[model samples]
Target chain A: MSRQTPLNAAHRKLGARMVDFAGWDMPVQYTSVIAEHEAVRTAAGLFDVSHMGEIEFHGPGALAAVNGLLTNDLSRCADGQALYAGLLNDEGGFVDDVVAYRFSAERILVCVNASNREKDFAWMTARARGCTPVDRSDEFAQLALQGPKAAAILQRLTPVQLSGVGTYRFTEGAVAGVDCIIARTGYTGEDGFELYCAPVRAEALWNALLAAGAANGLKPAGLGARDSLRTEMKYALYGNDIDDAHTPLEAGLGWIVKLDKQDFVGKAALERQKAAGVPRRLVGFELTGAGIARHGYPVLKDGQRVGEVTSGTLGPSVKKAIGIGYVPAAHSAEGSTFDVEIRGRPVAARVVKTPFWKRG
Target chain B: MGNYPGSLKYTKDHEWARAEGSRYVIGITDHAQAELGEVVFVDLPEVGKQVTAGKPFGAAESTKAASDLFAPVTGKVVKANEALKADPSALNSDPYGAGWLVELEPTDGDTSHLMDADSYVKLLG
Candidate 1:
């Protein structure tokens, strides 16, 4: 049995095709994946991301404790700001990638991937000493309102002055009479706001946003559209792209790792690996042939297995089959040619620069 | 749920076949397209290729996944919807008419195992 989100009833009533995602009963699509994906790219799309987990830390040492456990330098973030970071094991491999929101000097909230919630909480609780670590997953419901018209649509309901939020910034205010933390963040590589509110008020917020965005062409998107939208931007999904066995360095997320910063988990291993040089690196590739490259498909170089696809999709915006996977650092260069084996047939492919779909 | 024409024979795999003399026009049901979301690509079997009943002859890939297209009757594929190669969205918009997959010259014209529209609608429930 899977857990249900606060908005589960609403999704079912809208005729969404439900699927078991990370042990949560989630909608894969309410209408069509392509239409929903295109809506987020062009106009706006509302997404119930309440399945994502929230872990909070509060105390005098919350900032330092959080900085010690994650890869990014949290000290650089001011109050009411959020930064993308990764939680890594001692071996530099990902425990889970998260967004740490700094609400105050002593209060921090980290949004984690749903599948890794329990494990991430346990890991953080043991390492983040001198601070209170609370698993507040059930307390909050998240909604991602994304696309070009997102701000215009959200502004219709909230008087928060969304433009002042800025990218990676958040503010607390009432949206549709419901208190929420409106953060200017999204996974779609589009301008958007992620609204976090109490679970009890999820449906009300969802309903209000939908009614507000209806005139602006807002569609109720699902996990299927989410996957395609994120893939077009080359954003790594937790279980598929990054996992306990793969490090941030190998996943092209080295920019998030602050080696010069003070001691942190995985610091020693990353430093040692940096000194020795990385053997493999992740690269984005596009299939030149007919078949779509799917996850777990082998990447071949001269009929020999060189790597395997981590995440893939027929990008709705780009209209091309694109994917990200790890290969030898030598073969990770842009324009490098390789073959992605689709059902035993090697389809020709070439590594390309990421962000396959750039907003015009 | 889409209207399953009473004139067509249906397969449990969601394919439908309409007989026209010795030839059968085959396409996936509206329910199939609805379940598959939007079709982005339709990998059709080449003309002159033999297809066995209940066996997959091609694939219809949507953004979410790729589902194999099964043949409802044994036949030699006489024609494939070439327009679908450029625009597969027709499968979602008009599954029964313009979205027809192939025209087959039946080697054994038997559709005894297939169901009618009423039976297909019952299966959907």
Candidate 2:
């Protein structure tokens, strides 16, 4: 049986199409993926992301302990800020990509992919020094209110000034009478807030947000819209675009890796890989031919299989078939031509700059 | 939870076929389109292409995934819905009418192997 999130019942009440995602019974869409995708781009969309896991590090050395395990330099984040980072194995390959929220010197929170929850907790607990890592996955339910009108909708329910929270910043406040950690962050490349509240209070929060944002065109989005929205932004999805076998540099996430910082888990391997020059790199492309390139579809160069598509979708907002995949470094440049084999036929494609949809 | 026209014969693969004189009009069932979700592209064969029963002839690509379109009866394609190449959401909106994939001139003119609306509904259940 798949695990149910706190708002599972609420999702069913809203007539959502439910699917098993990362072993959790989550809503894939309430109405349709295209409508929900357009809503986030034009107005606002609310999402239940409670299936994502959260791990808390406590004690005076919390920051240092967590930073040691991450490829990004967490020491740079001030309190009330969050940074995206990669938890890598010693071989410089991703264990999981995560977002670390800095609450204080002693209290830091790491949000991880739902599929890597148990493994990530165990990995951190065994290696953490001078701090206690607690699995708080079941304790909190996460809701993402994303898009242009997110602040206006949220501000109507909370006394906390939404303007005070800048991008990637967070603050503890009460939303609809429920205590929540409101973080100005999201995966959809929209200005939004990710609210973390008690699981018991999730249903109330969800209902309240929907009611508050109804007139503003905020619809209850699901995992399907979430996937397409993030894909347009070229945000890497764990187990697809990034995995335990691929290093962050090869995944086009080198911006998050701060090699100049102190020694981390994958420091030596990353240093070595950087010196040797990364071989294959991830590239975003749009199908110039007839078919939609899907995940696991072979990426070809000169009629030979060179790589595979990691994430692909018909981008509703962009109105094109966009995809991301790995290819040789020579073919990873912008405007480089290749073919994505769709249904045993090679379809022409061209490498393009990522974030397929840019905000006007 | 889809409307299955009683006049059309159905395949277990979720295709619906309607006999039009010697030729048959073919398209996916409403249930199949709903399951696929938001058809973005339809890859139909050329007008003169040959297709065999139970064999895949084309594809319907959705935002989430792609599903193969199987032939319900063996025939030579007399006409292909070229309009779907520009607007495939018609598959979801009108699976029985505007969304018809192809018109096939059946070689055997037999559909005894296919199911009726009642039987297809039962199969769906």
- lDDT by residue (A1-360, candidate 1, tens digit) is 999999999999999999999999999999889899999999999999999999999999999899998899989889999989989999999999999999986999999999999999999998886796999999999999999999999998998998799999999999999999999999999999999999999999999999999999999999999999999999999989999988899999999999888788988988888999998888999999887877898999999998999988789999898898988898999999999997667999999998899977
Best by DockQ: 2
Worst 10 residues of 1 chain B by lDDT: B58-67
List the DockQ of the predictions in order: 0.62, 0.82
TM-score for all models, in order of appearance = 0.94, 0.98
lDDT of each: 0.92, 0.94
**Candidate 2 segments whose C-alpha is farther than 4 A from its true place:** B108-110
Specify the CAPRI tier of model 2: high
Q: In angstroms, give how far residue A294 of model 1 lies from its true place.
A: 1.6
- Model 2 accuracy (lDDT, Cα): 0.94
TM-score result, candidate 1: 0.94
